[model samples]
Target: MKQIKIGVFGCNRGGDYFRSLLANNADIVAVCDKDDFWLNKAKKRLGDGVAYYASFDEFIEHPMDAVLLANYFNEHAPFAIRCLEKGIHVLSECTAAGTMAECVQLVRAAEKSKAKYMLCENYPFMKFNREIKRICDSGTLGKILYAEGEYNHPVASSDVAFMRKYKPYAEHWRNYLPRTYYITHSMAPIMYATGANPIRVTALPVFAPFDDSMAISGSHCGDRAAIITTLNDDDSVFKVSGCAGFGAHGNSYRVCGTEGQIENLRGMGTQVMLRYNKWSKPAEMESNNLYDPKWNHKDEALIEKEGHGGGDFLVIQEFLNCILEDKKPPFDVYFATRMSAVAILAHRSLLELGMPYDIPDFRKEEDRVKWESDFLTPFYGPNGEAPTLRCSSHADFTPPEGPMKAYLEAIKTRE
Candidate 1:
């Protein structure tokens, strides 16, 4: 097998995949990052053999077969387009594009380029999620009618260390991230399992800002979660949350159909609960069965050691397989853009007090034209452009002055 030469951008997050990439026989030829701390950290893992650059302009010029874009959350599309134009395969991290305009541009770039583009959505590859997909594919679940996914992640407001590290500057993307902007983790698994494409979306915010007495870290967003509901092409409904903050930290999913339903038991560690009507149960099967899922993959040993419930390893493996086989990935450009559309539009729905928005299908020229000039965003741009949209549901809401000052002071103290 020819070793695939790959470059990683954004060392902090990208470094997490070093072991998995090596285990999959990929050569890490180059790495790029703006932060010297993270760059030095990457050096410790990759040693002196790998090329390092602080500028992507120079890094992208390196000879490589593909690039894993783990850059900023809202900045993958432009870089991915450049990789495609250079005929290099792109494995982009979550939230493929920041704006509708970029989504259109990415779709066009992928259509014209010879290289393939894949969204690295790992949650769909998690053990229980894979099992859910298997059951859904087997037709034992009957006609799917509804599904739900929650990626609740709550952090302590007192964790100034985390704030100093992740949301370093006031203008950082994380500070202005809307409740519905990080939807892939909560949205992708259900979509993948049931093969449902969301056509319409509506959302409402759970506006629970951190207490004024605590350090609010200069974050513009005050919403703890966004309850987003989508109407799929299959006429099914799905309810999901995007990086929610109002619950105990855990991911949970449930899929219900005409005759049966299946869900991963929360806090159960890979256990799944499958239930069916007595009359609709599979032959000799019980009406309800709860059990732990099996990895069942040849790389089970290696996968068990990887992150995100063994999803990180499987996602990379799938991306490499697609490149080797000269095939498009399941989460190809279309799928990625669709998810981004849901995320962007869902936030707009929240802003409008739950007004539904139609998700554009980039494959169609008409749909592409509709969003071609839609560049509205809730985040600050690379050049420090002011946000054109509000990050929180309450337009007048801002981080309290005292908390913001304390947050900044805490960061300075660490420095």
Candidate 2:
């Protein structure tokens, strides 16, 4: 196999992506971040040979074959376009574009440059989701009727460390991102499994008292948003309840089809429930025991040992394999963009107060024009007047005290 040279941007959360790249034994030529502290960390972790750059302009000019974008959630599109323009392959993180215009620009850039681009939608690589895709593809699920996939992460209360480290930037635009703004994690799997793209969306903001709890906890964002999306073939709903201050963290999915339905079991087990209309009764299943049964597989064991539900490893592995073999990553750029575009358009729907919005089919050339000249400016600016990203707030805005304060303080001390 030819050696692959790669550079990574956004070294903080992109740390996992970097670590996974190292584990797969690919050559990491450079790593860059806006934060000088993280850029140094990448240098230290990757050793003296790994080049570190604080300027994106200089970083893109580096002699590398591919760029792995772990940058800000909304900023990936512009950077990805720059890399593609330079003939560098791209693997960008979710929320592909901040606005519709960037989406079309990105697609056009990919086509014009003829470079490989993969959208990093790792949720589909989770063992359960992969198995669900397999089962669905087998035609065992029959014609899909209706389904629901949910990502309910209690990051507010649980991720104290995350809140503290990035708190300075948290008050930036990302903190106040719309509730539906981060919908890719939950919706990608359903789209990946069914091989369908969301055609249109009618979004509803789940504004309740929980929003106040997060604001009180110093979160600058909204509580939740639900999207009722119409897919090309199957009608489905995706809900992202990210009231970070409420409850324990859990992620689950349920897919109901014409012949059967599969649901992930609650609690510690990664179980699924399959009910076939053709059969007399329903049955339950576990994803790990079946498809990616052993987390210790040489290629995947390290992933299981390291990150979110063991998906980190698999996703990077696929990225490496594709680059080395000159093939396409399973979750290619177009696929990743499609999944991410849902969140972008859904947020548009929410901002419009549940207005219906059309989702462009990038696979078709004619559809690209609707958004090409458009740009959705983000809420935050260099001048620091962050736009007010609102959702209905019934949550109480009280500064946390007692154990929670002490806990947050302790984490801050460590940072």
For candidate 2, write residues 1-415 as lDDT tens digits. Answer: 6667899998877877777777778689988987877887777788888888888999998899888898777778889999999999988887777767778788888888867888776777777776677777877677766656666665554456666565544344445566666667777777778776677776766653332323324444444445445555345544443222234556667776676777666564555655565352334533222222334356655766757776777777777778777786677667766656676677667666678877788877778776676665535644565553343332333233443344345444435
Give the Cα-based TM-score of candidate 2 against the true structure.
0.85
How do all models score by TM-score? 0.98, 0.85
What TM-score, to 2 decimals, does candidate 1 have?
0.98
Best by lDDT: 1
Output the lDDT of residue 17, model 2: 79
- Locate the minimum summed-lDDT window of 10 residues in model 2: 285-294
* Candidate 2 lDDT score at position 138: 74
* Number of the top-ranking candidate, with TM-score as the measure: 1
For candidate 1, write residues 1-415 as lDDT tens digits.
9899999999877999999999999999999999898899999989988999999999999999999999999999999999999999999999899999999999999999999999999999999999999999999989999999999988888888788778777788998999899999999999999999999999999998875685556778889999999999999999999889986889999999999999999888999999999999999779999999898899999999999999999999999999999877999999999999999999999999999999999999999999999999898888999999999999889887877887777766433
409 Cα displacement, candidate 1 (Å): 2.0
lDDT value for model 1: 0.93
